[model samples]
Target: MLLKKSLNIVMFLFILHFIIPTTTGYTHSTLEKTHPVDREKVTESPSTIELWFEDPVVLHADSITLLANNGSKIELNQTNVDAGDKTHIITSIPEELPSGKYKVNINVIALDGFVIQEKIGFEVIKEKATQKKEEKLKIVKYSPDDGEIVTGSPQKLNLWFNQPAEITAIGLFDNLQQPIFLSEPMVNTEDPNHIIVEIGEELSKGTYQVTWYAHPVGADINEPDILDVFYFAVDEFTPIQQLNKGEPTNPFWFKSAGLKQLGYWVVFIGISLLFGGTFLVSIIARQSDSKKWFRITSILLLVVIIGEAIILILQKQELENLSLRQFLSVKFVWIPILQIVLITFGLIYSKIRLFFFGVTLLLIPFITGHASYPRYGGYLTILVSALHLFAASIWIGGLFGLITLPKKEEMKEWLNDVIPKYSRWALISTTVLIATGIFMTYSYIPSFSTGSFVKSEWGKAILIKSVLTLMVIILGYLQRKTIKRLTSKAFSTIIRRSRVEMIYGLLILLFASLLVVSTPSAAEQGVYPISKQDQDRELNVNFSPLYPGLNVLTMEFGTKDIEKVEVTLSMPPNYNVTYNAFKVKDNVFKITGNLLHAAGTMAMQVKVIETNGEAEVFDYRIVIPGEMRLNE
Candidate 1:
């Protein structure tokens, strides 16, 4: 009878999974390559715009259009697919484009009839100085010189230009294209020609590349800019190659990274079911026949083993070219293997000591999680996280056990007996879960500002998990209230609510898996904005990064009849430049330039000219954030 009831429950869940719709699995052909790649700066404008796709695409006369930063469309010749490679599409520019920012808009139809529309932004920089060849700037020397491998992560990067120059912009990227933390550049006071920047944190073992732009101290506006690039490695060196940008069809699930996340979710659910089922069978439902429950949970343990194996394989794939011995030595590699070994043993010794065995298994994941690597209170954090996971297993696993209970005539008596016992355990588990969860949140997120917390992927995952947890809590409360009065009508309702609670409980685990893969410091750059109104006209300006580097200034006006907008920036101790704000859309203007060369209060003068001949000038003062670690 127990076997038949458990089989029925499994069949019900199987049917429910299919009843709900799954996302489309049809993969769309993506853009694989681009000429003058996105955001690349070229010394000379190319005669053609080339785009290569993963599959052939059908192009129309208006399939490709080039637009300047000011929103003016540039003329282009006919679009054609390369006969040599059907996947390659090319279009020509009729005339040379002036030095400015431009975007290539593609609206081609892929072979699968999916419309692929995207914009690739790039910049054209033509040197205008007629100075002699000897006067051209050059890099005299630099530490961690190109192709040099250091013993460990370098603390600082130094550059010596032939002449004194100020760094306008700098970027340091690892082989995986992830940016490393860097402080704002500083010119050595004693030696004006030398510049240095602090590497905020020690980098992991990987090859790195640095690109920087500098302007000669006394050079005119038209003088050619100085650009230098170099590559180095820490501990080891490897050839660099671009990574693919393929993504999954559904954006909401895993943000283009689905395979590993799917594995993690499966492992989490499997652990919860096995742990919770063991607890219920041993402690709460001992009088009932538990052989069928043990068999069902044993199968879940196998599933858990498979999930861990898959995760291990994926981790190996991420760190390529590792020998089996070297791979086994990594903590990330061995932890899953250890779990698999312990679970296999548990499956073998099931009827004797599986409940106590699960207690040991529940503590393994925290060894590689956030708690193990916190900045402060290391061991305490690991303990808190372990308790949190243990508590979650009790609540979530108990919920699963409740939903699978047979609906026979003795069900009411069974509920009366088991509900009170499980309720006490769940109540205590809830307290532990909430307390540890609060501590984990406070430890993981470094800042609560809009840029650091709200805009980060880690924060988003926490919020989604919190919402699912809240829903489960409400369902648990409903169950607690229903237990006081177990009417016949309320019996079916309670069962339905328990099943829904289990579903939400599983979703919380899914988000927990997401949080595991996310980086706490992956936050968006800051944006500062100001809004003002004079008479009937309103003006809003937004400045991004708020640091001394390449900055974008965006503005919005009250009316759409504006003819032109001009902005002049003035900073004391010698800095003044004017830039024209181009119309990006209706009543919105934007400009991108290397402004705010130094950290100080900057004065901005905005002059707006309307089509009706009315003119208005506004003055505003803004403070730029001091030297900061970009990654922070």
Candidate 2:
């Protein structure tokens, strides 16, 4: 039955995948290609600027501007959508441009509300323009001209222009190309045309880029805007004095996706056995003395659930680059705490009370999960999730209760009678589970059936999970059939099939848990910020690509006011420690050394101090990538 059903499922998915609409119309809405191409160097100036998008674009605010090497704009008289093609945005250049490096900047808002920005560089060589001595209103000179390297940190940046200009905003980007948190640009009041931006913080040795937009101070509102971009490098600055590839101090938790995944598996089983088992035994009476299952199993299961909750939270916090204090403030942390208490009571005192409490326990996942969002049907999704969770738990837990029951003459009579009844319960539970699963898929997955199942990781997982679930149902049905025969040989078959069914059930829970971490296909494309919950004054920290390499660290502090912050990172092979983080802006900081040199449960500590003497301390675990790579 299992093989037959699995094949049927495979066929269904085959049809689903092939007959589905390609994502070509939805996800591929970014740059197809750009005019002059990225990093192109040209000898001739193009008469018009153009941009091509992969999909139909709904235009919002759009800008296509040309800029000189210095911070000054060259007028492109008019810009509009190409009459012949909507995909291309065209801008008309006024006259032949002078010989100088120029940058083209384009910013377009897609119909889906996603902002796409692109910049390309090219040089024109036919004619040379007069120097600053001439009366052209434009930038004459600037430092860090196109990929120039700096020997040491520069004191300040200087911009000279033919016309006096007022600064608007200036931005600095790091190696990862994220803008450094910065204050607004400061212009020279004494020299209206010249702007002097102070380098408040000394930059670590690395390649960086600066981009800015400004306009002639008193020009008409319709005049073209000045946009400029340039690269600068801090020559050979290594924050760490030395390297020790010989040994790593931290353990696997420093970057442990494996640890988190393991936590998910354990939590699922614990929930199944504790709540599901409790619910099972509450109504199913013992006959000929209950199968001699150990009473200590409840205690062990309780420990597993509580411990997994802790491990899961820590893993989530680390992956998000957030400190524990910040995580504690999130509404999510409370669910686990309440679960620990209720599950503790349920396990210690096995009664019908536990069955009711188990139902309440389902709410924890509901609140913490993505379904709680209003867009996914909010409370409606929560109710459906509750039904889905409770039913599956009872079904799986009942099977576990049977499997663990001692195979003596004692349970023979009781097991035989209960098997048929439990089978009926399992049927109902599986129905609810599958139905809710479909609803959730539709809620989060756009054009779910119309699009290829492989289009998104979420889709692939859902597809695989559905197939596995169908196979589990097949096994469950076969086990139910065996129970009806009730012969000695048929009983043996029941055990075998139930064990297989249980395994698949656990696997289904795994798939569901993983889907929580995934961004649904319908949730718009590209990396969406991990939705965080904040219920109090909490300090939240996050780091990206939590790997053995350099990564960006960000922090959001609760109760903001006038203050300074300090952050540090320590890496050890064995007591060899070093601090490698520098302040970027306000609460944000970046790591500059071999931060995660170990593959064990490495912990990084963060400290926040206010202008006064008050301070808050937080520590987070980040396992180096060995078993699993997180922080992606």
Candidate 3:
């Protein structure tokens, strides 16, 4: 049954890899903000344009272009960045122009040379015209969108604006301004914002324009009426017909995914054996063979820890863009350092030192892990996560020690005292492990639920770990049952079962290691949250990793379609940064930025503009956290 459980886990993982082998790779650093802003409306022509990106910019390889809707180009001429800040890019907009919309194209590179292209649109409208037509009332729909090429003759066209406005006249015309016949336009009394125009008959294939004049509600009557024009063309073919068809898909198996799985297994067994074997040796001094067994366990544990750390370090370096020097110097290096220290003291001096080194050895995974990161809980969760690691190590590591217990002629005499004491300690460690695991899970994944848990990689890992844990517990129960009815013939059978139980325990550790590498859904949701007093509207906002550095901000609206969002973080005395949040999914906007440079409280103001033109501002006192580390 224990072997069956391990086989089940392996099968599940095999199917998951073939079906869903983690499509999400490292996303390139995003361009955070622009001076005029993407799709912004400005009052007057600006002399300069600026851009802010999340990562350091590669200036020598970057380019920017400004183009008019009529195919004319506006020369930006020169580009520059602030000497002190590589994230800020600047350029000059030389000539001011008539009311029109322009597109700014940029090709940018990160320090590591990852390149991305973006096109931004900003409209230049006269101050008076802008006031008469509120920005939210701007046209959002069309008879056909601006650049669409339709195939079939269209008998009717529809347009929907963001809000209701007073309508005046409607005109239909060909490309040459030649008039076309159309029935009187219809506007639904219940939904006046949507306008529909019915063509009397289908016309020949050509370009056509729909023009209308209207005044927005709640505007001054003396203000000039607004004019809007939209165009669509009937072309030879639809784009869907021109698509390059491909054959059916095949299964994908990544070499990297396979290697990651391998790392997970090694680290799991390494921690368990290194700590468990130490605890086992401290209890047993009955036979001469016990000392030889302890020495063997020590050597094997040392090899596993060193090999595991190297594998994980290589994995991190390959997946990230950090320099080789930076990668080598990261917190992961502490693992091998601590391992060497523990082995030196524990082995040469005496076996008694193994007990101290054994407990401290578990700290390697705890120190560099995201679960115990300082931002989550000051010093509390870190301590709890460390305790959790230690408890699990004692429980599973001891199982490995049980496997090495004298299995031949000397086994019957040794098993009498060693089995019962180890069992009691294993029970105690198991209880602590479960309790701490639950506490830490609540601390980090507060949004935990069956639905949310299934959505995240972290949640999936936890689920698998729980399953393997159940298998180990069941095997422990059977081991106790075998011990209770032990006979002369059953000694070898009991040893075989205990060894299988050790394998099951190692499998639990495997899932736990995978969990360490995955990002929790809670963390992925956002970063440091703004203060409660700052919220003018009752919207739930949560940000992940509320530290002094880069973070992702997440906002959830109950039933509102957030039309626009503007966030400003004020690192008082000198720095003030603004960001435009973009929608990632349903009712959620994710904005990534560096909120501050030091540990202290900062002020953040979020202004949300809803689709109905309603706006609200929320003020928050952000507690900027510093990276907390465990003492060496």
Please report, as a residue range, the 10-residue window in candidate 2 with the lowest summed lDDT.
Answer: 522-531
Give the best candidate by TM-score.
3
Candidates sorted by TM-score, descending order?
Answer: 3, 1, 2
- lDDT per residue for candidate 2 within 1-632, as digits (tens), equals 55356447535533543343322112213364567765555567778877776443433322576889995988886667777877788777878877778888765544322234557778866543233323436667777543345678876778888778866778876665656656555667787777777776777778666778878778777867777655556773222223343543433111212334444555666766766665555556343223243364555456566545755555353324335664454344545566666666654455444654575457545544456655457678778877878888878888877676634664576556777777888898889988998887777543323232443445556777889988988788777767777876777678778777766776676666546544454222111222232223366566553444544455666554425444545432122232323434455444443345532235456666676768765655443333221111
Model 2 residue 3 distance off true place after TM-score fit, in angstroms: 20
TM-score of each: 0.48, 0.44, 0.51
For model 1, residues 163-254, the per-residue Cα lDDT tens digits are 88888899888867678899999999999999999999888886677889888887787866766566677776543434674532323433
**What lDDT does each candidate get?**
0.67, 0.58, 0.60
Error of 3 at 267 (Å): 2.9
Candidate 1 C-alpha error for residue 211, in Å: 17
User: Least accurate stretch of 10 residues (summed lDDT) in model 3?
Assistant: 623-632
- Model 2, residue 41: displacement in angstroms? 32
Say which candidate scores most in lDDT: 1
Question: What does candidate 3's lDDT look like per residue over 221-331, in tens digits?
Answer: 797887765556666211111134363342233212344444445655665576666667575423332566557756765666655565555545443444555444544
